[model samples]
Target: MGRQGLMAGYEDLVKKILRIRPELSEEDLERKVEEKLRSSPMLSRLGALLLLADELGALEVSDGSALPFDLSGFTKVSSLVSGLNDVSLSVRVIAVSPLVRLDGRAVLRMKVGDETGKASAVAWEQKAEELATVGLSPGMVITLLHAYTRSGPDGRPEIHLGKNSSVEVVEDTGTLPGVESFFVPISKVSTAGTFDVKGTLLMLSEPMPIQTKSGTVNVVEALLADEDGEAVLVAWRDKVDLLTGTLPGTELMLTDVRFRGGRFQTTVRTCVAKVARERHELSRLMAGSKRLVSDKLLRVLDVVKQPELVTLVVSDGVWVYRLPSRSMVGVEVKEGDAVRLVKGFVSERDGRKAIMTPEFGIKVVTGEDARKAPSVDRRRRLADISEEESDIIVEGVLQTKTPLGAVETRFGKAEKISFWLRDGEATVLCSAWRSKAREIDSMPVGKRVQLRWVRVRRNVFGELEVLVEKDTKVVVLEK
Candidate 1:
């Protein structure tokens, strides 16, 4: 090399060192570079300068810039040069594409990035199949060894892995920056594109089946929030499994999501993982005066039945509480019946107090104890029912009943029955699900029954239907 070119490289390195450590004068940096060269003979002037910069912590900031030497043996994403072979990198996976066949051969693509910048990467043949088998997802830190670089379809530098290359999940992720650092805060998301977000899962809805032109697909709606604000997120198909057991207050990291209709939806490239969880003890959540006292004898006021659970509105005479359970169907208690609640605590739900229990911890009160329980009956006329009102009580004769049939719901297969309720000139349809279907199916037509706390809604036919839910109480009045 020409002496002038070598001198220029040394001068540039000295200037970089001076910028980071202004205390080190140009002469001092030259002396350090000479000392490094003296200690390690065979090192060129530029190589010695690079070593000195590493010792001074200046090389770390050489992002997106070409370095004379790679002491760490890993190349930065932004510093990648096309046609370079055996290049190694440590980066976090931001997105991944499904393995596809190109010319009848398998190829997998991924978007990876480091703190420096982002880049596209691909694996072909055996490597692509291996990566697919490893379940590569967003937010995972991986190291690629012996990979080669080439121009991508967009005429930009891209990393490619072949038979000689290797990929492994980094065991110690602390060496690299956290995945959340690359996230665009939830509130600032406005454009429709692939983006990563970090926030707390404030709310999660039950997975529902939606009919599409292709087929029925399962989807879950969730509200994610950060300190700035909240936004909606929808998980579709296989991505719904990522949120299956997660609850509100869980910290989440979502990657490769697409924003549309003012909401973020999980795409084929999207991946979700829980970052952290806020633990709340049951006793701490139920610490209030209106809380339910465990093992207390309570009077049943109403019952609501749904496909997944049953809710009973019970009262301790002074305070009312809603108790819901999936196993409560086994208990055959009705309104005015007294039951002892065991191992249950009161917690606020839907802005109302409720009794939370792991199972049906109810024991029926009988003999003299039942007579001491409080009793109350409230009723609403069927003709006065409106779609806006909920938890309405009404009495009518079962004019027509449908045979019990099994139907598949999100909660699983359950029995269902629809019946026509007639009161004077007013007639309405009522549908019971799960255990309530069996209860209603046993009752003969033309019997007078009172349904308390039933929900009113219009069916698809635009006809008013009284919906019996987990908390609706069905009482048959035999005269």
Candidate 2:
């Protein structure tokens, strides 16, 4: 049979079921109706709605003599007939807030409107992306079908496109005869307070890997701007790659962006980071590099107490430096001797300056990389020092030796030099910034050295400095 004929036949069957099954339960009647309509592809779209209407008394078979169906305490389904058949209707989209997930799924609320009326739509996960692409603005008219309704917190019926709903965008009519404009400014669009925005990328930063208590996570920061204003956009994990090869002048389109932490920042909830070639120019500047300072080399020992930061290579030409701890990780470095140190800005940590290794493409020459990058001393164990005054003995090969020089400090002038002490577990940054720099400048890398000191100070930045006075001995284990 033809499509129209098939639809008519299903309608007749539905009418018959309502008339003959007045005493049947809503479920039993729905089951029978589904069985009859199963063969009709047209009716399949209405299967759930038909069953729901019959259950809620929305569909009457007998001359409206009191709906045979009981709606009782069940959620009321809104009537779709008003706007469903309006050919003059145009697509209108409303902005929604970021969905907060207590469970595994995120739930976002959006409103779709036409000349007839407005209806709310809920999107989860993948569907959310579809609605986002439609560029749902506050004034765009939208057409949707197969939607279901449920009771909202206010006891009023709320409309939403079901999982199987089909949504469409409708263009506006020139005059929209007899239809009032329900269009609102995009500024007023939001789900709960969050809104959607599209903009251009003005600046971007390379992905920085952070080692958290849970695991390693990559994060990137970018500056996004639109006609309205500018804001910071943050992307997480694999999304960080979006800005990898992108330049500062690139244009970007963002959805489900939000205001966070007193500033407008986009998180990974429903936001998308796409490079817009038409809107902005690709940034030609190479990714920034982070520099590892000699002081930080020692702090890593006090914190992780391992070779975690020793001889780090900038694999992707980008890295991250966390504050306070002055920890450096995930850097791209090539293997070579006399590793070149790149220049970069340093941020203050605990009143001390900490350098970012990746910002200026700076790299530190690992003593191992210096001479075939010596094999990591796996047997060396991390030392724990706690007492204010204690004598301890340590043995390790000198990895690198710095030139001795007089460094002016608050406590008068003193010779300073830095050397890496490796005992198997990890390399420790030993600095004689006050008294050893001149003495150790003559010491070559790879020469085993022994030192005895009674007092030392560990700085807040995790760097270790030796406190030498009159009673300190430095013995050369091997020349």
Candidate 3:
């Protein structure tokens, strides 16, 4: 703007040119400065000086990004700045965000963190294109050699990788200090950065078609979780397909998903998801060993025994589960017996919510035999315990029998017999103790039997109860 300001800018440029080409003598410098000033007509004196020096080949530029990042004598990210010496850094590739392009230049963004601190890394042009060829991913450890730092717009430290600089894959990083993740646990998820999440599909609500500003989108609500915590995931339009294909207790991973509007969810834009074909950790949950209690567990309020399907009711909800073979599940269930449906699919029929499961994914806990027994329904015979009466009076047909011989007992080592019986409605297990084992030398299956005043108790493994003591009347009602 003023003659004095113009002179100051030009003087600064002359000094920079001299620093790069110190061989230039005083006379040569004076002549170069005069020629540059006369040939360029930029308002800023420094602008004209730089323009002339560049065109006249008087300025020397470093071949940046031409050397591999060298870790030799490297330093920490928190220790470098814009004008500081270039140094190498070791960081975890927390996330690789979407690439940005402007004016024909490409820049790839990466959220990198290390034991000491976290920073953003930018790769320009060619370096950005080769990012995929380098096979980088989140949770991976990387080493950036000969890298430099600069203050970002927000005035925070940022890493800049040039042509010569490189990010080499090292190993997967351990838990980073003071660092969060794109694939953080459900409990730790927040509305902050672009991220991913992995969890089991606990429950999926019916897809509700809503009219949005974008268009009509089929929005499906889902509950997701791992061993740690849970979050509600909502999928719109194309992502709605995930609901039908997924099952309860399914292991899955969602990519490019986010947390917004107080919800942990994402649509299928650049986002993707992968699901385990078969149920994983389903047994642990059904057996009550590994419980994700809050929403993962379904408390059975009642059970209905169908020919090949079992309908379970919980509170105000109901599930119609198809059984491949009720044989494996011991179809006999009662009210209050907790049922963990691993791969149940929720659907709607006649405006009512219905659920189904694959034959192999079914597991049940019977109220009568469970270690944690609920009130059994005695009004209905053993076959139907939806009433939850554990009154212990059961008259059923003898289904099978096997002698578990020579079990040590209070009356010395005596014979033990295990048998299954069904009261035309449900099946149960019974054991004949020591002397009572003699009453029926060998139980004739297919015969109707009755036991009076038998003591019922849950066994060690929370399975069948052993009855038929010396005082108990073991009568063969029909053979």
Best by lDDT: 1
Worst 10 residues of 3 by lDDT: 316-325
> Can you give the TM-score per candidate against the true fold?
0.43, 0.34, 0.34
Tell me the tens digit of each residue's lDDT in model 1 across 235-310. 8987788787786567777766887656788876565656665454222323422323566778988666655556
Count backbone clashes in candidate 3. 13
Which of 1 and 3 is ahead in TM-score?
1
Off by over 4 Å in 1: 1-165, 168-178, 181-197, 200-225, 228-251, 254-300, 303-378, 403-417, 433-442, 470-475
What does candidate 2's lDDT look like per residue over 94-207, in tens digits? 434344343776556665444445545566665555555544554443444445556544344455554555554433434222212333222233343454455455554445
Candidate 2: residue 381 Cα off by (Å)? 32
lDDT of 2 at 476: 82
Residue-pair clashes per candidate: 8, 43, 13
Model 1 deviation from native, Cα RMSD in Å: 12.2
Worst 10 residues of 1 by lDDT: 281-290
What are the Cα lDDT values of the candidates?
0.72, 0.45, 0.55
